[model samples]
Target: MAKISIPTRTLNDGYQMPWLGLGTWPLQGRQLTDSILAAIELGYRLIDTASRYGNEDAVGAAIRESGLPREDFFVTTKLAGRDQGKPYVREGFSASLERLGLDYVDLYLIHWPLPLLGRYVESYVEMVALQQEGLIRSVGVSNFLDDHIAAIVAATGVQPAVDQIQVSPTHAQVDVVEAVSRGGTVVQAWRPLERNGGILEHPTVTGIADRLGVAPSQVVLRWLIERDITTTPHSSNPDRQRLNADIFEFSLEPADVAAITALDVGAPVKQDPKTWEEF
Candidate 1:
């Protein structure tokens, strides 16, 4: 893959975040460390992990071994559903920092809404306190809807810096994207390639990929970037990692973007934020 210039988006808190990142989920031990190291070597500056992912320790090890200055990377981790609540929020952040072997994380997020528990707001408030204490640089949420974000801001008067949610060509999430953008909050897409189960094989994606002479995954990721949304696609393969980041070399025309936008199926792949209470 050809080297491409990575882009960055300014968070509401004035922090610059790489528009593309390496997602580490369901990866642990040597595989996790190796993949992270490879991603860094492939020019991935942002690393996304979660307490539930159980790989922060490995992520920390890889970063430390990379010999790169701490400031050279953007690390993001999340508060698990099981760790929701004001007290646990602090404990979770501390634990994540310790596991990552870092003094502060670039961005900290509530992994889910868990609205039934009625503690997400409480947890976010505590995250705000951690941000003030310099333990967390910027605070945000994941798998959150527009109202969830609105409620947090309405209560604490502090808008989240980013809202990481599921977005792709099939699951466009237009409303959520617009909502976050309206608030000056950056939208980060998780599971960006798994939309509707087999996005890469979808006719729209494959057609565009064939036309662009790039992998289907690259087309999907580039489409997301073209929409100004941040994304972190996980891949243990070095070639795929490089392919995911090489999207900057070409531009997707407006017609292609519109055609992909027309592929929205109007449903999420899994785990609707409104009802999901998984811990």
Candidate 2:
């Protein structure tokens, strides 16, 4: 069988990123390593993890065992909110690199923009310094609103390469998507499958699934892909992993697209984008 190629998009920082990555969040121990190895063996080049996930060591072990040269893969990790200070930010990046067993990360994102502490600007300055030091290839933020992103760019003069937020069929962030795209940043969705809150059972999604002869997951992933957004759907099962990676073959019709777009209820099932005060 021929291995499929994951689509790539150029970041605002001039680096290319694979649109589909294996999100290693919640998987731990042998399960994490096993999933990473399976993902790589199945042609996944991008792997997303974080210090908060507590599975970087497993991810690193899998990469080292794969024996694919370091440059062949892309690694992304984020700094936690508590590690947002200047000195702590630098230290945190270094620690993450040690855990990932790499010299530098392809993309380093600020996990969350905790406005209450008012340290994201300083944390971004640290990211700029790390980029200058050759510690990180690109920089970006997650869960930031339009105003927050604008403020950061105004202060740093270096636009983020990406803005990762919770974007699915239901909690579609239209305004944030348009604003960030206008700013030349790639918008990535964390939970592309809608966090399993019966999104697969939704009548509208199932309707499209039935018409297109694809699973609800495939329908959702294709919808996000058509919108020109990057997505990382996590799964421990090899079948689901391959299914998630198999969405590039077919295309969704314009009417199907309209139907999925119309399913927007404008409410977050897991994390509320409006009052993202906690994280």
Candidate 3:
């Protein structure tokens, strides 16, 4: 049998997203275009961008230039926290669509919980309505805790299709993962590699990389794959981009999974919204 690559998971809302995608956060200028085009050429069909990323136009330009039809790619963008009102959600999605030059996106997400903003649930209501209008194919949330998801579902009687959180070996987020999984929502891991602070060079990951004869980055990505969470890892180098996609060739052992799981140090890499950040 042929080797199967790029596994996909079915969302509760009846859509499919590839197991791995190309993240476009913090990637800007000519580098954004070059990386996106390189990723597309490297067989990565899922491109995860957001209004906050400030690269939607670059992403759109590359997509148009790639000669790939809208159906051939899975494009995901998010509504910025500042745009979390009923009318603003509507305008935000429209602006994102305009920037991407698409009528509908594969997935639309609320970029942050923004509970302090005091209108996240109301914004989600608009997102649900937009789905009905055929303007949004799927609606979801990002950085949403269980309480946040429950509030939205209770108010609207519709659950978000996906909940994206920052997940990695270091920041496991097991509680959030369990809650979202129990709610039948797909979980997407942003910053899945946990860049900064020598994550890729960590002893646990580098050891696996040496054993597998692959780069440490590949080992880290595969670690996410084995966990079954959808990951969008951002890389600009051509070889690194291609190597990131090559994770499916080898499988990490169950023991290796357990070891990687133990690497979580009981703290998040970035600002933790639950305790530190106001959002």
Per-residue error for 254 in candidate 2, Å, reads: 2.4
Q: In candidate 2, what residue range of length 10 has the lowest lDDT sum?
A: 270-279
**What are the runs in model 3 whose C-alpha is more than 4 Å off?**
1-5, 275-279
- lDDT agreement with native, every candidate: 0.89, 0.85, 0.83
RMSD of each: 1.6, 1.6, 2.5
State, as a TM-score between 0 and 1, how close model 2 is to the true structure. Answer: 0.95
Residues 190-213, candidate 3, lDDT per residue (tens digit)? 887776458888898889889889
Residues 165-276 of candidate 2: C-alpha lDDT, one tens digit per residue: 8888887777768887788889989988866878899898898888879898988988888888898899888778888888898989888777787778865545543355
TM-score of each: 0.96, 0.95, 0.93
Pairwise TM-score winner, candidates 1 and 2: 1
Clashes of each: 0, 0, 0
Ranking by lDDT: 1, 2, 3
Better of 2 and 3 by lDDT: 2
The regions of model 1 sitting more than 4 angstroms off are 1-4, 195-197
Candidate 1 accuracy as TM-score: 0.96
Enumerate residue pairs that collide in model 1.
none
Worst 10 residues of 3 by lDDT: 270-279
